[model samples]
Target chain A: MHGMINKSIEDLVTIQFGADKWEAVKKKAGVTETAFVSNQSYPDAMTYGLVGAATEVLGLTADQVLYAFGEFWVTHTAFKGYGDMLMSAGRTIGEFLDYLPLFHTRVALIFPNLKPPRFECSDRHENGITLHYFSDRPGLSMVVVGMLNGISKLYKTPAVVTHTKFKDKGADHDEFLVNWGAADQK
Target chain B: MTDSAPMLDHGQFSKLFPFHFIVDADMRVIDTGSVLARVCPKIVPGALINDHFLLFRLASEPIKAFNRDFIARQENTLFVFKSTSTDLMLRCQVLILRDPERYLFLGSPWVRNPTELKALHLVLQDFALHDSTVDLLQLVQATSTSLHDAKQLSEKLEQRVADRTAELSMANAELSRVMRSKDDFLSAMSHELRTPLNAILGLSESLAEGVYGDMNTKQVKSINTIAESGHHLLALINDLLDIAKIGAGKMELELTKANVEDLCQASLRFVMEQAQKQKINLKLVMDNQSVMLTADERRLKQILVNLLSNAVKFTPNGGSVTLETKCDLESESLMFSVRDTGIGIATEDLKRLFSPFTQLDSKLSRQYAGTGLGLTLVMKLVELHGGSVAVESEIGKGSCFTVRIPCKGLDTLNQHNPSGTISLTEITPAETLPSNTPLILVADDNEINLMTVTDYLRANKLRVIQARDGLEAVKMVREHIPSLVLMDIQMPLMDGLDAIAHLRADDKHTDMPIIALTSRAMVGDRERCIAVGANDYLSKPVNMKQLVKTIRAHLPNDETL
Candidate 1:
């Protein structure tokens, strides 16, 4: 995993909770690294260890932690570094989803060792699409759900998202059904 | 063209070079790419290209002319242009196309920073995926974050240091306050203890001198024992007070001219009786008998006496103790050594010899009956005179303690005494008095002190008058015109210094001799008494013989009862 992912998680925990809580989480996880470099690569076990520690320390389910982390990644981490790029990705939410498949391909040029997850959109329409997430790692379907909510918030269109399929339940990959328009403004 | 190859169409070409523009031979805009049209709206298909963009350089140098032929001549050269409409720049390579003679300006937007990218309303996606511009911008941002982290850590460490320094400063101030409090308590205790001791010594002396009545042999021996014990207690109290004063930096020297031979003889005589009691041979050897030193006379004598007493105390029966003095004229210094042949000190025990109240062996303390303060006092007093004391010894041989006092900066050659104190010889009433008795006035708040002094005065056949306080003493002096007055400094109504000042203010009693008496034998007490117009100062408990001599020395020649 890239350090950007762990950095985002650190910023999410530290900003929402306190720095001391992040320290407690790190202690529980037995993580000794104090600061993370953005483009550096870390072992996959570190990220998994952090999620497990956050679950015990913050008294939250792993799914809830991943969901919050995903939302934070879109709302804060990505926007802070690449706000203009985010805005230029699409003029509308459907176009942004259409660009998501090629988003990691463009970013991977800058981060040479990036092992990016794949995103695809099918059954696309004016207000919704079926967002398919494919990755070698398991148990991250909730993060995609949270990222859809973050995108909807960025476009100022309230959204309703449902996990349509899960790889844990013997599906091919994870799938989400997302809908957003003036009809779902609340 | 290859037979099996596919060619790039106009739409494919526009997508490939989205910021490219084509110009005619007349430098007019014939066509513009999609991104160039969107960024600079002024460039149209029919407008003049020179009106929308200015050629900054051709072939990496300043452009000579604004014609298409000049641009075509600069082959394999990079052209730089700044947009007049949006202030965006372009680094381009010109290609000559020969369908109707056109020049294609094929380039992307030239962005060096993130701010420039935003100013041009460009995003990372606007550049082709293979461009390295976005990577450079992200690297810059990461370095800035690292700098920010370092700055924050430095600020936190500085704040921690300031907090720790403040804590240490507060602790140091509290320690100073505690030390001052302890010194004040010791000073107060010294005065309180001496006041009672004064009465005890004064009344006992009067009894021993037969002032009350004649006594039997048994009663006389008991009185002598009580006097001896009282004197011993007085010496211990004085030593304790001296140690406290020196520790507090309140001990001041009263420098005067003193003869070296006289000082040595007095010290040797002081411990002569103890030496005889232990059957030890005491001797004095002086190299220069007439050498004089300008120093604090009392403290110098005390230093010598303390060393001589220690030498005598440590020597066994039938052992020898010697006091040897030498005056080194060239060095302008004096050296005094006290050597003893007894159970000599061990090499390691010599280091602890000058530490206060520490005997080398506890058993030696019991057998020798010593307070163990003699060498400590000797060292301190010698140091007060800017001198050093050294000792050399072996376990079976003798110990020699030598003290070196530097007299280089002192006024040793001038042999005159400048002290204004009256030298009171031991005088009886029959020798000093005339036909009429002298009138003496005694003022004291303590009844025991006043009674003891008055009895001694009357026993000497002097007419005595008593006042309870300084206020009454002042009134008594104005009324009775006594020959001399003895004023106790601490009194109920008024203190002796104030009474003396009040008398000195009056023209009639300006010459009245008022001696200040106090239990506070501290550094500034005598100076304070003299500064307030006291003729002389005496510390209690006063020796009766000495008191009578001081009174006789202060008595007016013609004044009588």
Candidate 2:
């Protein structure tokens, strides 16, 4: 996993919970890192440990923690450099989802060690789309749902997302069905 | 290659280079890319390119011409031009197309700062994906963000440290204020208590001496008890004050060369009566009887006396108490141990023995009445001399308390004297008086004090005069030309300190001895009295014998009676 992802989770915990709680979470996770540099890679197990500790320390489920982190990623100013990158994805949520793979490829150029997950658009409709999320890391379907909602908020389209398939329950990969109001209504 | 081999159409070219423009040999714009046309509306078909734009740089230098020869010479190198209307610098790669012999300028606007991108009405998307300019913009923004965050964090940390320092400073100031108030209270309390006490003890001493008249045996015994109890109370108050002074860091040592044997004899004499009353045997053990020590004479005597007194008090009748002294020349330290073969102290009681007001057993404290401050004072006085005290005791055998004092500097000449005992020198009073009475002036504000002191002096065959205040005292000195003046401090209408200063200013009275007497026994009282020209200082509840002795010591032989 990239440190940018871990840094985003740290920001989420510190901003919402408080810096002391973030320290406890770090200690509970047995992670000695004081500061995480963006565009750097970290052990995937370290990141998973943080999430696991966050669940026990924050008194929240893993899905809830990841969902909050995903929502915070798009809205946080700590990653303002990625604002232009997100803006260059597309004008609306549907266009953005269609261009997600190419966007990740460009992001991989910026973070040379990034192992970006594959995003595919399938079963498209006028007001919705079936999003295929493929990654070696599991148990992050809720993050995708949160990100879709966050994108709808960005585009002012008012979205609702449901996890249609699961990888943790022995499916080949995860999937989310994203639906939104007409763009003109906003 | 054929010109028609699936070449990019106008739309494709416009999308590829949105800021592109083409100019014919006549220097008129033939066509402009759609985006460039919107930015510079005058650069359209058949418009003059030179009128709308300036050739700002050629080979990194300013070029004023956009003619054919100027364009032909700059072929492969980069060129920079600016739109006159927008003041935007455009980096261009020029291509010469043969079909129409036109020069096509293909480029985008150049920007250095991220803020410039916004001011130029450009976004990151305007630059082609292959260009590194957009990445440069991102890096600049990231650097700015990191610097801003670092500055904020530094400021926050500095603020926290400043706050903590301020809190600590406030606490320290408050503690100092409390300590000052406590010292003032102690000084005032001591002064107030001693004023009446001086009269009590002085009159009792006079009564016991039969100054009034001869008394019966019963009266003599009762008077002795009164004197004894008064002395005991004075001791308790002095001990309390000493403890307070030590705790306040105001106690100081007056170091002097003192004969160890003399010191031991003086200390033993203090507790000899008590040991005799209990029938406890007293013994002295030392390697050499003439060994001398460099120490504060008074305080060393006080330390040894306290240990011996405690030893005598705790030991049963017929038990032996011993004073042992050893000098270690190698370590330059002197050790004195007081061991008692009495009912021994329990092991558990030894730890709390030196804590003030702590008695091992309430029953024992009642049985053995004491202030319970002796050991504590001993420990503090020893520490002031850069020394330590240790004790060894058993449940049924006895207890031994040893004090070790380090003395790095001592005069070898005084270290040993062949004489077995050194006699203390004292001032001898005049055996005969002059025909005229010698006048002594006593100044005090309190009536009892004035009467008691004058009565005591008169009984010693001296003519006494009285002054109620410093003003009257000074007047009496000039009027009577008294041989000696006893000045009381803290009087109304000019204090003793001022009175002494006033009298010393006169050449006629400069030779007259003035003794400053005060009820306050504070740390700097004596020094302050002497600083203002007082010949001597005495703390009250004055001992009449010491007072007369001090007067005799300071009086001239011609005047003393």
Candidate 3:
């Protein structure tokens, strides 16, 4: 994890809720630094702790908080400087999701120590797809839910999501079912 | 989950598993659960798992030998299946019970959606409503669409930036072209104006010196005035060319050791008469015996002369102008200061004093008449020497202009001339030795330039043959085979450069001295003339002394004797 990730999370909390919420979240996370450096790398424990603390401070379920943060990462983080990179990778939400494995590899250029997840997309159809999610760490599959919602918003393509299998429920990997509708006209 | 596989399972199991079966050690389906019996009523207990069902991951193998959780080196890995009677495929989880030595398989139908299960020859009420695969499918679809939009936006922005950059560079190129045109215009004007001035000044000299006829006192003085006025205009024109050369970084210098004292005293002589007329007291102050540096003597003299003349022009009647020199041993610098006690410049004007073409009192009726380029030339010249000039003045008290240049002596910083072989100083209008002088052929298109040079050479008692064009000159040179040929570069028929090339190529006149005369003083013109086979080269408005000396230097010694 990097301080930029923490800063982005802080920014999301502050902007979506309020400055007071961010202050409480930061306090609960036990972060001593008032401000995180944008480029400095920090321990992975710090980022995971912050996410957990954010859920507690905001009085939201862990799924809701992680899912909201995942959506925020796309709308905000990708826009920071990686919009061109993301754009070059994919033109549609389906294609972009299919390219997630490659995207993480490219993201590793910027974050050298990133422990990125592996994504495998299969059984693609006109309306929906089966997405295979693999990661070394476990128990935050709900964040993928939020990320899917954010991506649909980015593309103006509304979609419904269902968890096919849960890593928490002793499945080998988390799998998701995605069904898409026509893109929004606007 | 994978790191803790292969515990011989018996206590923990799902009793309500769909399509449960037990396979004995001999690959035989010994017993079947009630649900399996309900699903397949005619199927007996002897039906093998592989014979009855086809696994999508792997078909159930004949259970011959089981070792290390892999029966016959193959594992189901939760194989998916479809019943022989129904179109539904079940996701089967297998448990090999090693203690009882039985195989238990639990099967549940794979459902991508609740609606998808209705067409699979099964009732909608037969299975549960909850399925997570549908949500996972939606996540992948949305991510791809967003990236495509971003790609489109980025490409558009990149194209816009490229277009803007191209426009800026094209505009920059046009501006550079305009600047070059302006520079060329100034250079051409300098050369064009000076060519005619050379004839005017030279003709005036011949008249004043009684070359054509005798002159009375008033006529002589009038001619003198005209000549002096012509020289002043010529100096201003030369300054235009010199500054242009400096700006283009084409100015070259010839270095020799020059005495600072001698340079100052000699420069003082040029302004002595003017100072006397103004009743200004001129003085020289020296700090030591020797003040010397490696420099171009004539250019250094020109600098000293410009400073002395400025000092004299500004000083009032009975005011003093002093030239001071100091050899600073501590810094190894030669410092020259020109101090004047006339009307010192205001503090505000001092900042812009050396700017080109700027006269503080710009009115026509100002006390000093000048082009206001003298100080600019001085500043540029000092900079060329790797030095600096500064001024200190108080209004109406006095002004001291100081020049400090490093004392490099004679060891370094000698400049090489990119022009022809001969030096300007070495050419001093050869003292007319009288031994039937050399037979010289002069070629030029300008009648006035031709008349001026011919008369000057005739006065020195040299036998001269004239040609109006390069063709005529070439014919004359071949016919007369004169001791020397003075060729003008730009001519009406076959230019001087071409004629020189022709003359040098022939076997007859291979060693003949051909001196190039050009009115255009642009850089590389001299080099072009010499490269084309002229023995030496000269620039127009011809300095009569220099022209005569160049001719004499290249002429054979036998011709002079």
Candidate 4:
């Protein structure tokens, strides 16, 4: 869940989600090598890929992962409350995202349930290499920590918030938190 | 009290009051007079004045409406009176005197009754009706008189119109008759005079041409003079006849488009030869190439020939006669001029140039032999073309005779193509003479004309016989198998046309070529001859050339040997 392995998963999820909204975005983003792999039980391949990847790493079901991802994605992706934003703009959510914040405030009131996550940093040293995790759930602790490390390596920001705190703990809850963390970055 | 002694006279008061009665305010008969009771016994002295308002109705409205005394005393005892005997209504004033309770009254003048007013209105209506009746009568009388006068005036106007119409008709008839007689006289005179003249000309021509025999020089000269004089006289006669015809509105022009230059040249050539003999230089000054003029070509040529020849004749030796032509563009007229540096005419003599038989100088006239009709005929010919001729001259500088003739453009000349050349193929030969050859009897009182015609026939290989007069002509036709005859129309014993008619009646020479040879140049002579069965007519002194041509035309061949 750290290093290349975790970074690959996050990259796949980003490609799947971005391509699902606009097919041309993946090609324009230069991510042709990325492909989706999911649990067959999930109905939508792109959604399953996003959720199953997070779940495998964090230990959560597809529904919990997707819901959490949707919320987090709406709030921090510059496409927050995009559906309601597009409604006010007389366009679709994808069109709202393309237009970005000029229309973001018009729909900011619609996504009241979505909030920014809290952040915690942890370090684990192994084989003389150090690994970091930032998480709000114990269940998704390893996944969130791996994703944050990948983000931090890419953005050079170790202090970035990746998840919100959870009162309960488990792999499912951790997977949810990890998915939420991925949405937040989006 | 003093009046009480006289107040007992009721009968006297009755007569004075007449039919007077008065009423009080409460409808009681407050005062009365005996005369009112006597005038109407039905009205008692106390007859309650129940119908007092009836007095207002009987009175004139103005009097009743404006009675100030009655209007002021509504409750006062008022006196109301009526006089029945006089057909009058009266109202009297009742005044409260003495005690201011007892009433005293005085009667006023009566108002006229409605019945008397109605009678007066009826009398006025009768007068209006009577006056209207008299007016109606007067109007009827006036209208009747006006109608009578109008009828008389109309009749008089109609009579005047009828008289004028009748007078005009009579005048027209008289004018027509006179014109007809004049025409007849001219025709007869032309014929009578021309017949004998033809004989004189014929005989003289024959003598001059030496057809009878040769003669001494003096005799020949005399005969030549006679022939020449006769020919001149004939020309004068022709001119006089033309002038008469033109005056009578009988002369008509045969208009054709002709070449003016050619005509002038030909006319000048004819006269210039004579001018050369007189030592006069006849010159032509022609600037135009050719001008086509619509006119009687023959008459136009006659005019030019006359003027040029006269100019030549009057000019002395070495004098020049010039014929010039100029065109007036504005008027589209061709002005032809014959200017002569000859013995110029006097101003007085210039007026006589176109006058018939009027020569300018008697001495000059004696030198020249002419009928003085040349210029007259020239003027007439010019006038016939709707043109004019004028003369400009001084006594010695010479004279110029200008003729201005209206001209049509050259395009119009195509209508009259003078080169009337007919193809030989169109010339159909005349009918062949009969086997029993027609003995054509030539008759003229003049023996030379007879011989000339017979000799012409003989030269043409035709067996022509002769006669001396119409009687001989008729006799010869009867004696021979004559199929055609040429008879002199004016011969002794019988006229040629009459002889031909008599022969035609006998069925002997009915279809003969009894060509009338006469000097009668009048209009109807040829037609008259043909009417009487003359096959053709030839005017004299007969043109030998034309006579031969006509003879050949009629008798194509001598098949009837």
Candidate 5:
């Protein structure tokens, strides 16, 4: 991933996981990739790549577009991962989504553009499911689809996702929509 | 008629325009206008007009911005200014009458002298500043006076505190001096009473023991009565002094952890002989095994002994005196009771059981001999140990005296050793003194005491030297250098303390062991004797055995004897 994209991921993780949890997630993700990142260092290539993708999609400079993408990605990813983990442990996806507001309320209030992803779990099927949303800007679909794919593999579940076009609505500018269902059923 | 000269002061034109001009605004002298010259003396005809804009700049903006058109049309326009060389301030204003192009018209001058106004202003300013200075000066004077008053007040208070402290110290010193004198007096009195009593007791005991020879029945009885009466008197004296010492707070407790059971048994045994003589059945019923208590062991023993002896003394033939002890584990206290089946205390006399100098009744008084101090001392000692004593009695059922003392834990047991017994094996009577023995000095103020001791020594074939008083004793000690000096505590001219101090102060007699022969059997007398450099002390009417042993103990190379 480009450094800008990685930075967007990190910023998103920070928003989703709080400062403490962000460090843990960063360490865990770094360990998985065998690329050790310290909390103190400058942005890497993956961060730039993510930022570049976000800027192209949002029609903004890398700096302005990177900040929003970082926030949105971190918040949506954490909510989806948390809902999936809860649902896999025999929790109803509806109940998991209902509980999401308690932990993700700060992100929802701070980044109004970021939305909680829809969750789906099926008891009749062997595989669990999750779906996430991202903007349908130039390069975002590829990055978002790839992230959803990676998450699906990471959680050992199937993920379905979609997007919406970004609009200049001042504070309510960016938008997306996601739906998730059990892969076996779908 | 300067009409053709163009009437300079007034207009002769067809229309009268109100315009007036002076070439120079500085001087009152005017060129074309006559009225301007009369109104302002500084305006002059030919002097250049001073620009007013600089003066206008010094004026307040509001006044300087005032409408020139309004002033030109106004009836009166007057500008009053006060000026120094470097500064000018506008003071007042008046209205302008007409436009400047009009014919000249004049009004009376409204000018006030600037020097007078400035002087008055300066005087008013000085008065305001002086008023504050006067107020500050008054305040300073008031504060100084208050400070002086406070210093005087503090000095008086300090003097009062100093005076009170001095008075209190003086009173305390006098009280301490009086107490010392009282202790000295009591000690002297105890010695005086004991000396003669000792002589009587000693002589009687010797006679009863048949030391001189055997006696008939009547003689034996008479001697026995004498010895018994002497002993009783001595006991009474001792009791009264003990009560006095306790009341004076002179008695101190030597606390140790004692086994209450052992102390009670020993005390009971001590009174057993008396119980046997009285034919009273004495028994001990101690249920508590080895219960320990913190106390002065000797004093505790004394208390138990007194109670037991009192029980035995009051009990009639075949009556029983029972000693019982019970332990209260929760309270950690031991209760010792001496119940006697004898002439029981009357309900009315029960209150007097522990009262000093009180016996049961006159009837029992004749039958029993007591100083009545035994019970009082016992109660005092028991109270000292944080304990209490109570009595229960019926007229003929006997009296029971119970003492409750708080108990100490087992760790204190090691501190409670009974006083070591002084062995009498080494001492021999005066009659056993060998012939040709060294001369022994016997000092006693009482002639009877001196005679009795010397007679005993003479009978033993030992040479005797005598002294009438302590001073004489010291004199004799210096002259004779006797083998031993039997020094009396109380004597005329000088007492034992002075004589001993003097003797010990000297080199020759310092090592010569002086045996204190005193009748004062008070608790600290023996300590006092040794403190005054006496080798040992023997109570008056001293047991011949103890006296001889003490003498032998002090003698050099006399161990074989």
Candidate 6:
């Protein structure tokens, strides 16, 4: 994996908690990298370990940490060029959900080694839809729901996102039910 | 085909070269893409290329005309263009074709963001969805993220370093606290252990001396054994503490000029009574008529005592123990050696002779009763004075322990003293005991030390008064104004130091002799005692005989009294 993923994890944890808490997480993870280059390649296990260790250090469950990281990833780090690209994908939360597959395909072309999860938006409507997510990696299904929530908030159309199915539960892949619009408004 | 028609493959061109335009040698656009004409409004079939756009790199180079050579050289450099109408940046690959003498501009919009495409009125569908634009945009984003991460990591690392530094300082403070507590424990332990031993030996000696009334031979023998064993235990404790202080480099050697002849006779006379009781002969040999060395008199006497006692103990009833002294002007040192003819030590046992807490044949057998510290203490004392001690022994022949005192590098000098030299073959006190009875003050908090000291003074025919603590001692001194004071240190209410301070403060008693009796044989105990106005220092289990001698030496010789 590129260092961008690992660096994203660090940025998210530090912003949410504090520098001390992030240090505790890194220590728990047994990570030795004092500095990380954004474009340098790193082992995938480092990022995974950071997420797992952050769960323990921050007194949060594994899924909760991943979800929080998912929300933080968009607001804190994915700005400037990537931010504009995401904004241009769709004008509304429903449109963005419909366009998630094409956006990720474009991203995979830029990052050749990236194993982006394949997204499928089915039963799409103005108010609600089921977002199908298939990935070679396990876990992080809750992260997809969190990312959707963040995107909905970015578009100012708050959505209630819940994991409808999981690969760990013997389903073929993970799925999330995302509902938004005036009826789903908080 | 028409002359102004685009001369490129029609089928493959639309998909791959959808953004290209053909220009002739005159720099006029001969033909342009259908998509380009919509996206870029200035592009027409006959419009001049430079009139609508500016090339970023070639504008600064020395070139009047652009050609295939220029295009080939500029291939590594991305040829970026700014549109005059739309303000959009363009990057193109220039291909010079020979068939129609035209430059094929195969390029795409170079915007890193999608919203910028909106400014040009173009959508994702307009560019055939090529992956190049996507890769470029992602590359720009990654660079920005890397810089942000570096800054964040720097700040966090600084915070972590600060936390660690604070922890280290706390640990250092804790270590200092522990060391201070350990020193206090040693001081307290010194008094706690030796006080009881003082009582055991003092009472037993009093019993054996008939002060408490004597008994038959069996009872006398039992009392003697207790006193002897108690003294032995006291010696071991003193040696162990002295060794610890010397190892720590805390022992103060009070350097003074000592006469060679005096030191030799003192060594011989130290063991005179024991040698005589065993019917062993003692002799002294001197290489110089008179010599003086800068040394600690008290510590030098201690080394001599260990040597003389060991010699007397090893020499048989019919044998002799000889002490030899020499002043080596070449080496600038004074030498003292003790030779004894009795049961000589074996070669293997001699190797470990100076190691403390070790006994060879004496360990299992009861023939010899000793703490095995005498020689060890002697070696350490000599080394503290920057000297060396060695031994030579032959089984069945005898053993000889020789110590050389080096005179160097300290506040010490070797000199030849003619007046102080008086070689006496006999072991006797040069000055007779005080002829008249003198009033002496015995001050100590421990009852045993008080009784023992007063008894010794009384037995010497000197009138004695007792003060159990420093306060009473000072009060008695002011009232009766005794001729001399024997002060025991480490007392309750007021220590010997504070009491001496009080007594010395008075003008009339300024010259009065005060001797400090301390059981804490730590390195600086004597120096502390003397600094407070003590005339001399004594250590416990108090030596009654030495106590009497010290009193006589301090009191006026009837002329002043």
**In candidate 1, which residue pairs clash?**
none
lDDT: which is higher, 2 or 4?
A: 2
Question: Which regions of candidate 1 deviate over 4 angstroms?
Answer: A1-186, B1-24, B30-37, B41-46, B54-82, B90-116, B200-273, B282-308, B322-338, B346-357, B368-393, B396-540, B543-561
**Candidates sorted on TM-score, descending:** 2, 1, 6, 3, 4, 5
Residue lDDT tens for model 2, B1-561: 387776888988788788889989888888887777876787789887777777876455555567987888978878788877886788899988887788989898888766676566665556666667766665665555556555555776788779888998998899899899989988998888777766778777667656567999999999988977786777778899999999999988877666677667657756766888899888777766666677886788889988998899899999989888876667778889999997777888888999998878899887776788889999999999999999999876889999999866533533663432222222111212243767788898765466567646755767677777899889989988888899998789989999999999999998899999977666798999999899999987788889888987888887666
lDDT of 4 by residue, B1-561 (tens): 466576646556434543345444434455556534433455554554443323343344423232334534643534454443344344555544333233334453342322232322211111122123223322333334345445555776788789999999999999989988988888888888777877898787656555567899999989888877776777777778877887788888877566666666556656654776778776666555355677776577778878887888878888988888776666778888999987788887677678888887788778987878888888887888899999998887888999999875634433333432222223221212334554456677664455456545644545556666778777878887554677777777888877878888886555566678876666798899989887789887776778766765665365343
* lDDT values for all models: 0.77, 0.78, 0.69, 0.55, 0.57, 0.74
The per-model DockQ list reads: 0.15, 0.15, 0.03, 0.00, 0.00, 0.24
Number of the candidate with higher TM-score, 3 or 4 = 3
**Candidate with the larger lDDT of 3 and 6:** 6
**For residues A58-79, could you state the per-residue lDDT of candidate 4 as single tens digits?**
4566545544444333333212
Q: Higher DockQ: candidate 1 or 3?
A: 1
Candidate 1: lDDT over CA atoms? 0.77
Q: Per-residue lDDT tens digits of candidate 5, residues B234-278?
A: 877877787778878999887755556556654665675577677
TM-scores of chain A across candidates: 0.93, 0.91, 0.87, 0.24, 0.31, 0.89
lDDT at residue A126 of model 2 (Cα atoms): 72
Q: What is the DockQ score, from 0 to 1, of model 6?
A: 0.24
RMSD (CA, Å), candidate 2 to true, equals 12.0
Candidate 6, residue A152: the lDDT equals: 77
Tens digits of per-residue lDDT, candidate 2, A1-186, equal 866678888888999999999999999999987567665678999999999999999999988998988877776733353665565445567777777765565556655667878888898777888889999887877777777777777777888898988899998999898888575232
lDDT of each residue in B461-538, candidate 6, tens digit only: 676676768898898899888889989876678888999999899998999999998765557878988998999998
Candidate 5, after superposition: displacement of residue B260 in Å?
3.7
Interface RMSD of every predicted model, in angstroms: 4.0, 4.3, 16.2, 61.8, 41.6, 4.0
TM-score of chain A of 2: 0.91
Candidate achieving the largest DockQ: 6
Which is the leading candidate under TM-score?
A: 2
Q: What share of the true interface contacts does candidate 2 keep?
A: 0.04
**TM-scores, all models, native as reference:** 0.56, 0.59, 0.45, 0.39, 0.37, 0.51
